[model samples]
Target: MRKNFLHFLIFIFVFCFSSFSKSETCGGADGLVCCNTITSTSGSVCAIPANNKYIFTLRRFGFENSAGEVTWVGTETSFNAALSSVGASMGNFISGQSLPEGTYVAVRPEVKLEMTVNGSGVSTSDSVACTSGGDQTENLATVMNNLSDPIPNCSSSPNEDCNTGDGYMRIRDTQLGNFTVTAATARTINFEFDVGSGVLFTASGGNCAFRSMGPLDVTMSFSN
Candidate 1:
């Protein structure tokens, strides 16, 4: 009986140690999935897109109008181009779920913005700085037309917030301007879920913002 009890205790100790070791090696700078805080405006947490391509759903909060069903826009090599491909679905309801993993050959249908404002307002447009590939060279121009003035408010400098007209602003990736996104940004913007060492999804051109009534819910997906 004593020998059996000793063996049981040893097994428990080994199990506990193994679990603790796994937890320590699962997240943050030491590993991936850093468990950062997703916030308003693209930051370490919020702006950082999903690194790998996986099926996902988008949920919108506090929308004034009844959101239509999810739809697909088109697939471009990056965010700077236009509808390279289109899907066969469209509706007026929001709340997208269970998108399969693929190239998303169209504009994701559920580009809904959530906020508490009226009509439309300007949102601050800023580039997270990404690589100079594809349509990246025109990212800035895309931002100016799509997101600035008509979309989100822009600051003369980086340390400014978008006016968010009436507490509501819409933001989206454009195909105009471009920059080299940071490591964190690259990991998050997983359109293909297969970014090369120096490739990333860039926000530029006319996809910077959209017409909305509140803070935006830019839920994107990843593909291969």
Candidate 2:
């Protein structure tokens, strides 16, 4: 009887330890979605198909006002491995939300749109307003400035996405540096992001319009 009780207690300890040691896998929505900016002659893209394990949906949209384009293209790239790697390493991947630990997805989708605004939408010299997300939308310039270099109140200011100056822009997962993807599904890097903006840019000012670039619902998948 004594031996049986000791064995039972040992079993329970091992069981609990094993369960606690297991790393949570991906399955449901990780809750955080990040977006990176890329310039395109085609135009702004919103959504990309969710077929790739790591999906990086690229969109190109410039801010416009009644006067003209408030924001112009500085730079753009469709294939950025290093940036994607940083994305892959970060982000919450659980068993219920997001992809599984070793799951392999193989399709990439892309969409485009544009953001046009007015003079009132931008704020050139309002530090207090720019710092506050609530007061940043005074005009197209303010909105674009806020998007690229928002002066928000947080332990860390000026999110990583906007750290890089110039035409370069990116919005990464908020969970970055706090989350990790398992080595199994981490073999290939996949990324995805959704962004919205109402900022315009121009040397001076003119009638702003992105018109319509239609949608390029293209699907791309790779099998391992």
In order of appearance, the predictions have TM-scores of 0.17, 0.21
Please estimate how well model 2 matches the true structure, expressed as its whole-model Cα lDDT. 0.21
**lDDT for model 1:** 0.21
lDDT (10s digit) by residue, model 2, range 23-98 = 1111112321111222222133212111112212233322232232122221222321112232222221111123
RMSD of each: 22.1, 21.7
lDDT of each: 0.21, 0.21
The stretch of ten residues in a row with the least summed lDDT in candidate 2 is 1-10
